[model samples]
Target: MPVALEIVSPEKLLLSRNVEMVVIPASEGEMGVLPNHAPMIVLLRGGTIAIHEGGKVTDRLYVSGGFAEITPERCTVLADEAVPTSELSRAEGERRLSAAEAEYNATDKNDVPSLDAAMDRMQSARAMIEAAAA
Candidate 1:
């Protein structure tokens, strides 16, 4: 049986469909979701979400960061940002990375929150660059 996968960003609903499996970049690690999978909520990192069907990966999307709620029948992702991997631009990613690097360098080390946020941006930008290259 296929599992229902829904990926939504703050701007819009990016995808809603049934797939054989999904591999997500969870905070703990990569996770694969399939029909009848156990229920849980996962924190996603900046990386790719691969949709599997017909014994192969049919689609891939890059998520900046988000959380996913998974149940036996459905997996719903609420992403901060979502874009098709094919649409990712290496030049854009590079620009973002450079800006993030500057922000990180300017952020005070003692300001944990600001530092963390800057670091997250850097990570997401780097992930986008890698995804674009793939």
Candidate 2:
């Protein structure tokens, strides 16, 4: 049985389909969903979200901050930001990661926003790395 799965962002609906499996980046850790799975609501951490269907994979998405709702019939992912793994350029990811690290190292103790921005950049880069690897 395939479960309905949708991954949505504020700007648009990234994916909507029926799939065999959906791996969620739950707040505590990773959680896999399949048809007839138990119902639950979960907060997601920043990471890669994978989907499997029809013995083929559509694509991997690097999502930052989200919530997941899984039911026996459907799986829904609401993310603040989501970008396809293929969309991430390997060279860009590496370059951005380097810049973020450098910025983080240069930031002073009171520059919270700068630190956070740097962290987000690094996280995004890491997600791209994971997606590309997969």
Question: What residue runs in model 2 are displaced by over 4 Å at the alpha carbon?
Answer: 99-121
**Candidate 2 C-alpha error for residue 97, in Å:** 2.8
- Candidate 2, lDDT over the whole model: 0.82
In every candidate, how many clashes are there? Answer: 0, 0
How do the residues 12-75 of candidate 2 rate in per-residue lDDT, one tens digit apiece?
A: 9999988889887786787889999999889877788888877766667888677988889999
| TM-score of candidate 2 on Cα atoms, chains taken together | 0.74
Look at candidate 2 and give me any clashing residue pairs. Answer: none
lDDT of 1 by residue, 43-79 (tens): 9999999999999999999999999999999999999
State the displacement of the C-alpha of residue 79, model 2, in Å, after optimal TM-score superposition. Answer: 1.3
What is the lDDT, from 0 to 100, of the residue 126 in candidate 2? Answer: 72
